[model samples]
Target: MTITIIGTGFVGVVSSAVFASFGNVVYGLDVDEVKVRSLSEGKVPFFEPELEELVGKSLSKGNLRFTTSYEEAVSQSEIVIIAVGTPSAADGTADLKYVKAATESLAPYLQEKTIVAIKSTVPPGTNRQVEEIISKHTDKEVSVVSLPEFLREGVAVSDTLHADRVVIGATQEWAIEKLLDLHEPLDGERVVMRPESAQMSKYAANAYLAMRITFINQIADLCEKTGADILEVIDGIGFDKRIGRHYWYPGLGYGGSCFPKDVKELAAVSKKLGDENNILVLMDHINEARIPVKLNDFGEKIGGWEGKQVSVLGLSFKPNTTDMREAPSLKVIPYLQEKNAIIKAYDPKAMDEAKKVWPSLFYANDVNEALDQAEVVIVLVEWDEFANLDLGRMKDGGWLIDTRQMYDKKSVESQQLQYLGIGTV
Candidate 1:
């Protein structure tokens, strides 16, 4: 299968590499000359585990290439996958200008019976809109299929190759069969559905996960007030197979490239459809308020935030990725700054990206450097290195505000430090 993936962003690059590694010839197309050139040289623009290696191997195998020209990439392809970013518009709807542009650009170059798979996360009727856009530009029989991606940023390569499910949303039998055959090597369940359902599936999945996080965070708040431990409560509820234990993490709320944007879009969609009162809207509101609320609580526990040397551990949203899109650190760092706290931040891989968003803040060379002479420490993202931090490096009687609940309270106390975790008595 010869494939052309439009967009050189996270999803496009990963899809290109994975598909090419499966023996499909893939061309990664992007408008940015520098990014296309970088990718052609086997360089990934962002930090994702094992992605550069996979791209390098696929390039070496002569099955993967990168280009700036749509004609060069899309003309000879059997499947054109649009994995462009559908960033949130001002009205909270998905901005589909990129999707529409990609469809228009590729329409003229699409071969007869080509499968145009949309791997970008979009609203329910977006596939139909893209199909209409394609119809306006070309007369060729191109089948637009809603092939929504479920790749988590940090482990995108693994997720692409071994996804939990591969959805093929198309009306044409031939289009469905061709897409299924293209994804035959991947180890995931095949879900065949309508385009709208496929699009909604991606939104619904993210919204449900966001709601779960919101639910847990709300419970954590209650636990803190009632002197109940959230960990024990989670353990107690996890035994019931219906509720499940996974994704019940109590933290500074859910923040990433997908959840925040998807939830907002879903809420906007619901509001536009006359469903003004919905959980989606409330979930987003609570998630947005989590950082400030938690920070205030931490401030009260630590005797206020003024004139303190605060060491912030972890900057990225979660871990193993340098992406800071909608990360909790975005909210956490600024709030501390406004409170007149001297900030010393450190992350394993996100310092560079974090510096871009927060250049005024002091970035530590390492964790030890960040902890040096620190009066208070705040754990934002749950990176692996933070799991076993040496609490003794901080000032004695300093506060450890564990927003991610990464550190044990007893362990911090052993080091003569006051430990504060979410949902813990």
Candidate 2:
């Protein structure tokens, strides 16, 4: 299969590499010339585990390439995948300007009977809108299929190659068969559905995951007030076959590239469709308030936030990636700054990215540097290195605010240090 993937972002690059590694010829197309050039040199713009190696290997095999010209990439491709970013607008709707533009640009160069698959996270009717946009520009018979992606950052390469399900949403039989054939090398259950259902599946999956995180956080809050341990409660219920134990961590709520924006988009769409009291709206509201609320409670626990020397570990939303979209550290750091707390922050992979957002922040060289002389130490992201941090490096009586529940309370207490964890009593 010869494939052209538009947008050299996270999804596009990963897809291109994975597909090409499986012997498919892939061309990664992007309007950003600098990014296209970087990718052409086998350099990934952001941090995703094992992505660079995969891209390098695919390039070496001469199966993967990157380019800025649609005519160069799209004209010779059998499947043109639109993997562009659909960022959120003010009203929480997916802004599809990029998807529309890509469709328009590729339409003129699309070969007859070519399949245009959409891998962007978008609203239900977005595939139809893209189909209409392409129709206006070309008379060629191009089938637009809703091929929503479910790749999680930090493990996108693995996810793409071993997805749980590959959805092919198209009315045309030939289009569906062509997409299935293209994805035949991947490991996943093939699901054929309407375009709208496929689009909604992406939003629904993210929203459900977001809801689970919010539900656990809400339970954690209740546990804290009632002197109950959230870990024990989770264990008690998680053992049930009906309720699995995955994604049940009680933390500073859910934050990443997908969950927050997807929930907001769903809530906005539901409200506009007359379901004003949707639970998704409440879930998003609570998540938005989670960091500040937890921070205030922690401040009260450790005397006050004023004049406190705070050390923060981890800056990315989660581990194994440098993406900081809606990360809890984004809220945690700024809130501490406003409260006049002197701060030193450290992360293995995200410090450089974090520095872009907060240049004046005192970024430590390592864990020891950040923890040294700190009055309060907070673990925002659960990176592997933070799991066994030396508590004795901090001030003897300093507080350890474990938002991710990464440490045992007794262990910190043994070091003559105070420990504060969510939903722990």
Candidate 3:
């Protein structure tokens, strides 16, 4: 099968590379000529661990190629996947202008009855909108389908290769067959459903995960006040067959490209459906509430940082990916700056991206440079390199706060440094 993917963002790039590796001729399309050209040179644009190797292998085999011309890709492929960006709007709805524009651009060139699949995170009824747009411009009978992606940022490549399940939403049986044939090489069950339900499923899954993290963070606050440890409470609760363990670990908060936007988009979708969304509203507020929760905890630990040198390790939303969109570090860093804290931070790959947003922040050359002359160290993001940092180098009277609980308290205490962590004694 000749598969062509539009919008070479994180999802588009990762999915195209995987599809090519599965023995299909894949063409990745993007508006950015520079990015497409970089991929053609076998260089990945983002910092995803091991993606360079996979992209290199696929390129070497002539299975994968990148191009800025959407018309050329659409003319040569049987399966066209729309993996564009659906950024959040001011009204909390997914701004689908980009998705619509991409569909419109390719509508005239969609030769023969090609299967057009949407992998972008869009609001419900978007596939119908896409179908309407395509039918208005072309006489070709296009099979429009909605197949939302559910890959995490850090583990996107692995998740795509070995997905838990594949959801295919189509109106026609042949449309379903086209999608099934595309993913038939994989060994996972295909879930067939209506397009609206498929769209709702993606938002529902992300909102529920956001709610879980918010619930645990709220309880962690209560545990801190009531002299109870949250880890023991969570461990005890996790053993129950009813409540499985995942997304239960308490931390700064949940922040990434999906959870925040999807929750708000779902609430907007519900409002359009004429029903109030209490749970989703609470999830958004609860996730936003952590900005103060984190800053207040830092203030309490460092005794009101006015002119204090604080070192923050990790800037990305999570480990293994250089994505800082809606990351907790952005919220916390600015708050510390308001209190007149001299900030020094380091992340293996996010520094270049972080500098674009936080130009005034002291960019450390490495973990040691970030910690130099620091009165306190805060592990903001759980990057693996930070899990074994040298705590003995911390200045006298300084402390370490493990917000992600990615540290060894015993080892730090043995080195005579005060170690504080969430849900730790």
Best by lDDT: 2
TM-score of each: 0.98, 0.99, 0.96
- Predicted candidate 2 versus true structure: per-residue lDDT over 144-256, tens digit per residue: 88999999998898998899999888899999888888889999999999999999999999999999889998999999999999999998899998997787978999999
The digit string of per-residue lDDT tens for model 1 on 1-425 reads 89999999989998998889889999999989999999989889889999999999989999999998889888899999999999999989999999998888888788898999898998888877887888887889988889999999888888988899999889899998899899999999999999999999999999999999999999999999999999999999998999987778898899999999999999999999999889998998888888898899889988899999999999988799999999888888889989999999999999889888877778999888888779899888888898888777889899888887778899889888898999998
Off by over 4 Å in 2: none
* Candidate 3 local lDDT, residue 55: 91
Residue pairs that clash (backbone atoms under 3 angstroms), model 2 = none
Worst 10 residues of 3 by lDDT: 416-425
Error of 2 at 27 (Å): 0.6
The TM-score, computed over Cα atoms with residue i paired to residue i, of candidate 1 is 0.98
Worst 10-residue lDDT window for candidate 2 reads 126-135
Tens digit of per-residue lDDT, candidate 3, span 81-133: 99999988998899999999999888878878799999998877888899899
Off by over 4 Å in 1: none
